[model samples]
Target: MVSRIDYDRDMVQLHEDIQKSKETPIIRKDRIRKSNNNNTNSVHKETLEENIKNANTLHLDNDIYSVYWTDTIPDHIQESHPYIAIMTSNKPDHLDRLILNLLKNALVDPDRILVFNDGVDPVLPILEKYEMTANQLVQNSQTHTKVKGDQNQKDFYINQHYRFMFSFIFDRLHLENIIVLEDDLVLSSDSMGYFTLLSRLMKYDPSIFCVSAWNDNAYLWNSIPDEPLDHLRFSFKRQNHFGGLGFLINNRTYFNRIEPAWREEGANYKPWDTVVQNSMLPEDSCIYPSVPRSQHSPILSRNYKAITSKENEVDEWSFMQFYNPADFFVDGKYMKVYRMTMAPMLQPEYDFNLDRSIRASVEIDSLYAIGFLTTSPHSSFVFYHRVYSDKDKDWELVTKILSLVGIGNGGVVRTVYEGVIETSVLGKRLYIVGFYSKFVFEKHRATKAKMKLNDLIKLVDYGNAHFNEALTKSYLFMLENDHSLHVKVAEQSESCSTHCKTHNFSCKEPYQILLLNSGFVEYSFTSQKYCKTIKIAENSESELGNLPSLYSATQTCVLPNNPSKISCSYTPAKNENVTRKLCICNK
Candidate 1:
């Protein structure tokens, strides 16, 4: 692990500098100095070297201007500068560090910096010493909700933290725009400058709800060679699924649209980020740079384990060269857009309420309906076992066994079993099947057949309750034996119950089919009406091959409780890609 620099040294130095320069309380020049090149400490030297390497393309001198914070708000800033509020509770160490970073990076007016403390008396003296007002909110017995049971106190405090910050900014200060940051947030040298430009963009286009200073995918994108294009790289209207460490909040949209909706929903137990994203105005987006401008510090977090990883840090020299927002456009056109991959689909909720009496027989035969084998249940459902691969484990094991005897074209090893299931519709019946390495089948034949369910009522009820509410018909088939199962949904008047409400998904599309048990998916198109295809490459603009115009669909069966699958129903544009390599969510 690369050792992190001791920020305590820099903080103490900055505090000393501020005390000595009483005439100008702010450290006008550099906030934290880089490590000396001649330092004997090998760890510090390696860290500095790595930092320099990571930010080689930053082009700080060409794009970013030197940060100069005034003791008071400049005339221009009073008219347009955003009200910056830092939310805090009890951690004075984190608060002091954050304030130090702001003094070094942001051109903040002392009056513009409001620290909303949630009844933390210790932080009061610290705030007074800095000449910054700490508006402490009430945390009485009635004010602090009962944070017992499965409820997280950290989440409860965080929700109230936002409520207090926003109320202080819009309701008390009567500010139109504001920047809300946490006590553990650390900003880059050019974070304020970049945010200023983003604010200007948002003012012109109401489509943007807010501007996030941190990009979630910045760490991954930064490692790519010669991409992101420095300050030229920007994301389109991407959703703010996880709240950035620091972000600018539009007073009108957030205070008016989002706040009211969240309040009505009873914002007692929900995360603030989820509330903000879910309650966003129609078609509005949160814009961010390809590289993060601000990041959470590595300090111990109240909610998360660690807010900042090694990858979250930006280069010390990272800065944008643009003097104005107009620099973002060229020749009356905006630059190309970059985006993070869409999140994957949700996992399916299998109907596991059937009888388990057939388990012993199925275990003996080596093949049984996966929907019945509770022990080997997930093995048959490959989509659920994403980490398990036949090529890596199963095939290797089989090969090692065969090669032991100098085997030829390996013969198929079959396992067989028979069981009886009594259903409401179909009375007592005996079923026999064989299991090969990949598929399950009739004891002796090689034929694909639709899965025969003993109880149609149970299947229908399960499909409607768990899969699609308006699914008129469902057909389950053995795609590759019984291990790889396929289920087709037809005559759907609406979408599945778990479709993303944030996305304006239409109900007019046809009901699609899914290979439930298979992890490796290869689509076979029978209809040629839609032929235009597009593929997205990993980096830069490159062709990835094309499939026919297909609508993006999402299923919860793959990653049941996580970010569900994103399907494509239309042809992606030339050089366009999904948010990720696989499990595409959006265009």
Candidate 2:
């Protein structure tokens, strides 16, 4: 078995540390067998009688949602459809190497890429030069002749980009569902299988609106809590809006009945949310909630150059597998966590809300950030937090959940949206493909939320597969050097008299502590400033002594003066694991 911890740091972060390092051992692709090809168009295997019985008794409500849905859907559909189209938006002069990094991380087969210019055509030349695969080609009017991403339509451009993309969803592919991507997104290896499964499932269910975990409301009237990537955890059971969702759509039906309203609303509202909102069947309409899940935007994002220094670290799971985003059944043990709401867009501003801030946490076991939502300005977006939960040990909750694979919640959905009563169908049983655990905290990052089983699985998987693999450093090294900490210096003892010379030691003025022999100490350490903490112990001997000193264990610490505990944790790190095991000494 492979060791979970990478004890060799220099080996992992070889490039920067070593002038040149040995090539990473190639893990032959042959070892991992590709699953057999499948046809997603397969007709249902169950008899009409069984289907009716199952739909009514077990798989009841089509509205029961989850955060861990992204993973199961893939297992169910991989035999059928195996590919997803990643529609990446390109930008220029990205100093952070985000574009390159994501391309390396994407689970998408580069051949299936739809490089939307997002209006920046200049990046095309760069993309063309760097893109590795032939299928990874640019898509503009010239390339996608059948689509509306032409050189024109600058007037309604804000909404146009979204409209054109929607039009393209139906225009380009023969597949019933498509997985769209933005350039900045970094996908895991499992994303393709996950999307394909959901797409196949969508083809079977005419009413399933979309299969993503992200939700945002740029065009709504009130504050809607953004859906976490635990795709199974929290869902309107039938509410639709927006977040970066690995959104699965019934393109033909969506375009035919909803496109007109989308067009009209697009004309009125400059934001894409208007068009998406109009796409849903209104309250009076009978066919609207036929599936109960079509949406506008479920996401969060930024352009490469605009906010490029850091990788957009997102929670890894969705509501696909777990019963709740905060609690779930893990390998034999019940895993429970308590996470706060770190951020809420369009709600109480950062100053007003203290509960929802970004903080570091081991929320999930494995996560796959297949997709999230971004915007035209790069300031705002949403996401489809798709997650895949791996159940290593069987527990009662896990067993019970497994027993209900294609089953729905207990009874019929008594609630009606828009007077259209929805029914539970065979596929209505919410098995998932990816996870959807999405929590957005604006400036205050310390107050983040917890995740369910599916989220945990995705998070763990992301770390092993990407960060520890060849083109990178294992997370251990990353945490060791993490400098985004807000530090503080606490004075344990009272100030000494003017002149005494027994236990006094003089600490250099520049350094934080001054221990003078006379006991007169002008002792100081960094105030409440940019600081981060590890599990390591901080002592005067380890910090200020002249002898070769040994460091203590690293642990996450709190600096409360300038920012609260939750508010202090900086932005997330991708495939990013924070270990409270490393220790560093300021020499």
Candidate 3:
């Protein structure tokens, strides 16, 4: 367990350290100067000092500790290495795990690692053992009390932690670049080497603001398995949004652009990451790997928490298989050079109109089909006419389509491999290509009409034959069944609300009890016809007064059809000579 320290004493020590560092002035090599021009370097140095002074004056929820170093780092090390900044809170166990994983990197330098603690708990001993720098920001008691109840104030404090950390790294330490990591994440063996190679890309490309080690759509259900030869290739794609898990940011970008507009005080608190993302120019973008080099643990924190009362259990076993270092594929040591192509407009080689015969031709690789999308102004759902092509690869065509529909180009486009575009249109999750693709009447054209769901499913089925079998099956199942009626088996002891919540659904009280006949047992819930009548209150025992006995029957919880509801079904054992009672509850 992480032990707590005296907050008052820590604050006093923090104040003394800050004052001492200010009082003692020592001559040091100028590290922040990026340009060779003497006049420009002098002006940049003055601006940096002014920014540091302004940052020190900002209201502090926590005290900032100076970076500790025994000697000046050699010029070669300074030029090639970025200070590794680890942001941590009270989670010592997570911090320990992160440090251990980080140390496993062959290219990692202990002297370059810096821990920025939130000051609730200090792991000074861990830092000492690794010979790493510790910058603990002890919380201010008065500020904490003032921000206790107000959510905006809490967000401000959280945002301020980032401000303080970034300002110290850029303005005070004078580092050119820093790789930021949260304590909850574990780095892959290639993480350091990956960043090292990407750092060159950052220096080479002026338009690229950040390089991230995370693939936003790299979840097991979304990603494709790589072959042995695929491991040798290090592929990266451009994204407008900053993927923040494990990212590298330069001092020039921070001090000049980001720091100036940093939110100091506001009634509505925007997250620091969001502010950074919003501040980027239209030309600026971030580059991230096709496969992630860091894996995030699902431990709850201020930034991440359970959406509902019941904790949703993620399939970590499947997720870990994607992040296994042995399967990382890219040899980071050998992969040093990266050739990044700027925004290249790719015109479709061939475009065909939506039709019934197009499904067979879609199975051919490198085929691009123009699919018509229509949205009912009254509803949140989007309807598609045919198989959707890869949004990112065919962005030029996508832009033209969006222009025709009068929708602007500012919306983020989320891409999943194998010609899939997962997006939320009007608050509803719309899988444009995969299993959820729907047909719509093209009213604007006389020749276009709606296609059957079965036809669309067959297209996806044929197209995804070489893909993961489990994913393909799930996609087919989703397309065949009513999306509103989601059913899953639950423990006999689990409550209706909890069961619904665990499955990412809300629970409505007074669920229905479904009674299934013995002969209909072979059919699934979607196909079987059952007598459902008994209404039971959530979390209460059913009073089967005058009803058939359910002794020796097995119960299964069925999720509601409409957004958040719970329905249950019960089936009797074959050996037990009793009629089976199944209960289903709907909102």
Question: Which model scores highest in TM-score?
Answer: 3
- Tens digits of per-residue lDDT, candidate 1, 22-71, equal 32222123222332223223442244334333432223211211222221
Prediction RMSDs, each to the true structure:
27.9, 22.9, 19.0
lDDT against true structure, model 1: 0.36
What lDDT does candidate 1 reach at residue 61?
15
What local lDDT does model 2 show for residue 526?
A: 12
lDDT of each: 0.36, 0.28, 0.42
lDDT of 2 by residue, 128-194 (tens): 6665444445355433222355434433454555566666666665545555554434333234433
Candidate 3 ranges beyond 4 A from true positions: 1-81, 105-107, 133-148, 225-233, 263-268, 298-322, 328-587
In order of appearance, the predictions have TM-scores of: 0.39, 0.35, 0.48
By TM-score, rank the candidates, best first.
3, 1, 2
Better of 1 and 3 by TM-score: 3
The deviation in Å at residue 211 for candidate 2 is 2.1
Model 2: per-residue Cα lDDT at residue 556: 28
